[model samples]
Target: MDVLTDLLQRSRARGAAFSHSTAHGAWGVRFPVGAQLAIHGILGGEAFAWTDDAGTSRHVLAGDIVLVRGSAEHFMAHSPGAETVSFLGHPSVGPPGGAQRMVFGEGPGSSTTFFCGAYTFVGDLCAGLLAGLPELTVVRPRSGSSLRATLDVFAGELLDDAPGQQALLDSLLDVVLVQALREQLAADVHAAPAWFRAMDDPTVGSALRAVHAEPARNWTVADLAAEASVSRAVLARRFTALLGVAPLAYVTDWRMALAREQLREGATSLAAIARSLGYASEFSFAAAFKRHHRMPPGRWRTASRRQAAGLASV
Candidate 1:
């Protein structure tokens, strides 16, 4: 898989806090910042998307899908001046695998309709990916675009309590979200992480997949190039050019990321973790970890556990 696909999968990104909101004249609903990401789709009449306290707004119309790239409060409204209701921490953020609907304007003339959902992503993978995106991203339909098709299906499934509807809606939402992300990143390739943009180089992409798939392996430029069917010098140049890091540095960073996860889990021996990450011994691993993380692995693990405990109590 390419780097973007691999990042999202490894992060365990999934939908949460879903809602199918319907409204009429003078309506607004605010989705507060807590979800890892949020998606707001305008399935019916025109509306306005209010993104921040600074009063920034974007006009959205029918068939438009907006992906909020990070955990920040945003809203949709019938007009820029509509009264707003907070959806965050509301009882409507319901049980697992189910959705809620909120109707506004309190009249039978519900002219506008939309569906919204928030995403929950685990792990550090989200940080690097979302950092490269603007706070708000909207997808306007174009002729013959598969994104519009997916959004259409998503819209139809809403308010329909047919059998297996939850599963179908989840699938459709994922498709539309992924397509919106792909389109946004494609529009501004520079907005994507360097590793994702690096796929333009076949050798770099191959090497990335190799390192990600078997991070425990002892990887060198020559070894990776041999696996990728490219010369050592070519691989080094291309890898550096695209990822802004040498191949070995990338491997070390990837390994340390894994080590951090293991540390967070707090369920394995330090030596075992080091070995799984391809270190010769725990001593060597600790030294390397200190050099990168600015603290010893054992101490880091302890601190992480303590912090988690504190949060759990809260």
Candidate 2:
């Protein structure tokens, strides 16, 4: 798979708390800090979001989406200094087959209607995608951006309590998430992972996909260049410039990441894991894993499990 698709598939979150909320005069909502990511899209009126109680914040007009990356504690309001409330007692409704809604502020006044959602991720996931993102990302679409059109449909779906509404809303959220990520990935290509940044390069992107799709392949830079129909010198120069890593080095890192995941999740033998990642033997794989993770695979697995459990309970 390509880098964007790979990140999305691996980091696709679960048990998301999706809600459509309305705020009229004098309103604010505080989303406390946690690992779950918070996303907000303004459909009507406006809202401002900030990471701190007093810092420069992003103003969101209609057709704008904001991602509170890394789940930093944040506040959203029609105005910056509005009286805020916790979501604990917020009027929320999720009819059996309907989208969830939360309403606040006074009625019959200018209201900012928005959709907000949070998704839970396990195992300290999204290392490549989320690490490349900032503390907050606001997707302000220029013309021809898919995010704006999708927001319109997503907002309409939130209004009705129709059959299969929950499933529909979930699917729509996925679309919005992917679109936003794609936009960000495009804009932040230079700073993102090689798989993401290299996607625009016809030669480098094909090489990236080959490595991800078949981690077992004994891939050299020359092999990848052949796959991309480019010469070795051209591929090497372009790959290093665009992706910030040589092709073979990236392949080794990717292999180790896959091996680590298999070690953490599978009861399969070490030899199997090593063979799957194209290692000649378990001894070689263990030595590489030690270098990548600063610990042997067995110890890393134990420690990683403990850390994951700690994060889950927090």
Candidate 3:
């Protein structure tokens, strides 16, 4: 699997709470801080978007998309600093599969048609993909780009109340999420995470791909070097320099992340998780996990699940 695809799958990101609305002249909507990630697309007209503390807004024209990461309260409006109202539970913005139609301003004025959606992530593993993003990332739709084409189709689907429309929209939202991440991350290479940026390097990228493709394999420096067609010393130096960690160390970290997710879910036996992550036995996996997390795997799993339950109740 490629890096982004692997991260998305392992992180278990899911689409949630989609709504389509139109606003006319002098209108703003406040989105409460909740969703881990949110996306807004401008199908027609224009608007401005910014976080609560940003103090400035980004102008988004027709055929533009804005991505906001983290649990930051944000706003979208026809004009910057416009008076705002709570978006959640609004009459027009009902639950999934319901129609949404919002209106603002009494006069006949220019209207902005937009669609908004939220994404929920299961665990901190998602930080692998979302951690490096700024609070608000905007992308202008380029003519002939897949993102623009997909947005056009999404807009069309929003108008139809056909069967399976919800499922179709859900799938489209996933596509939009991936495409937006690919475009924005590529556009701002300097701000992207080292693992993502490293994927462009021929030697390091090849070795990384091999590791992700078969993470359960017992891999040595020489093994990964061969996959990249380079010497062990060369691959080690480059991988460390680019990722700030040795190749084998990165493998262990990734494996541990997967292990934690499985443990959190309270599914799969310890031995199964161990073997899947290339551990010789459950004992060895427990030892390594304890060394890294300062707690035994079983104890850590219990504590983590308890904490999750507490939070969910709140």
Candidate 4:
């Protein structure tokens, strides 16, 4: 799909409250497969547990951003316990001592507490990226940094519980997810996929921006190379080196993504979408869509809508 749609599909939105006390000792929170990424920010007290996915666990504490890109089943608690729960446990235990989860560094004691959220990806490209990451990504806040302050604000807002509280929390979760993505991208050292690295190359980034900004344009290698102020060969070489795909192929994929999004939104007819994406005929557009997505545009739209509906029900 288009880059923006890819981001949304490979992401999910969720917010949760956690607590701990002497009676219950340790507990776990399980997350199902719908989310591609999850971020846990300590909101209050201290939270301790072995964060595990596929049986490997790491300890998490307050002021830590536990990022689970694999969306694996994991838990946070006061102690590591013998019993484990599936990702779909019901009416889970609240935090200890009847204390609601609170903002970290607020109220009284050094109790560990936090707010967590998860994001599931729906698009193919994003799903691939998520599949490539480790089970968990942890970001410890730097002292006196804006990220730390932002986390504090997030925890504070969560504690308020004002009107439209759920929606507000959802928005905060989005912010946390975006920040985590940005940090992960910056720290990633391995060879990344085209979309992830394209934004970092001057020439390729410019070309990508142009394509995304106007996928309807009649784009050619010559035109894009000229726009990037490079010879055709040099442009092609650099683009492929950085993005791992030829320029034309990338443009074609972007067009397909844009068309898929438009179709799913029911914003335009197939013919209109084809024309707007620079295709001369609806048949030509359908053929391209079939090649990329393995289905005709209409069928893909129906299937995608059905999948989204199923996720909502879950």
TM-score of each: 0.88, 0.90, 0.95, 0.74
Quality of model 1 by C-alpha lDDT: 0.80
lDDT of 2 at 306: 89
Sort the predicted structures by lDDT, highest score first: 3, 1, 2, 4
Q: What local lDDT score does residue 250 receive in model 3, on the 0 to 100 scale?
A: 92
Candidate 4: residue 285 lDDT (0-100):
91
Q: Would you list the clashing residue pairs of candidate 1?
A: none
lDDT of 4 by residue, 1-314 (tens): 23433455423333332221121334445545545566677655455544444454556655677777644466665545435455343433432322244222223334565665656543454655665556776666556656666777776765564665556566666666656555665567463455667776778777777787777888999989987888899889998888778999988977876676677676589999999999999999999999998889999888888988897898
Residue range 165-272, candidate 1, lDDT tens digits:
677777777777788888777778877888877776678888998888888898888899987899999989889988888999999998898888888878889999
Leading candidate by TM-score: 3
Q: Clashes in each model (backbone N, CA, C under 3 Å)?
A: 0, 0, 0, 22
lDDT string, candidate 2, 28-107, tens digits:
88877764567788899988887873377788899887887754688888777566787656778778757677888774
On lDDT, the candidate that comes out on top is: 3
Count of backbone collisions within predicted model 1: 0
lDDT (Cα atoms) of all candidates against the true structure: 0.80, 0.79, 0.86, 0.64
By TM-score, rank the candidates, best first: 3, 2, 1, 4
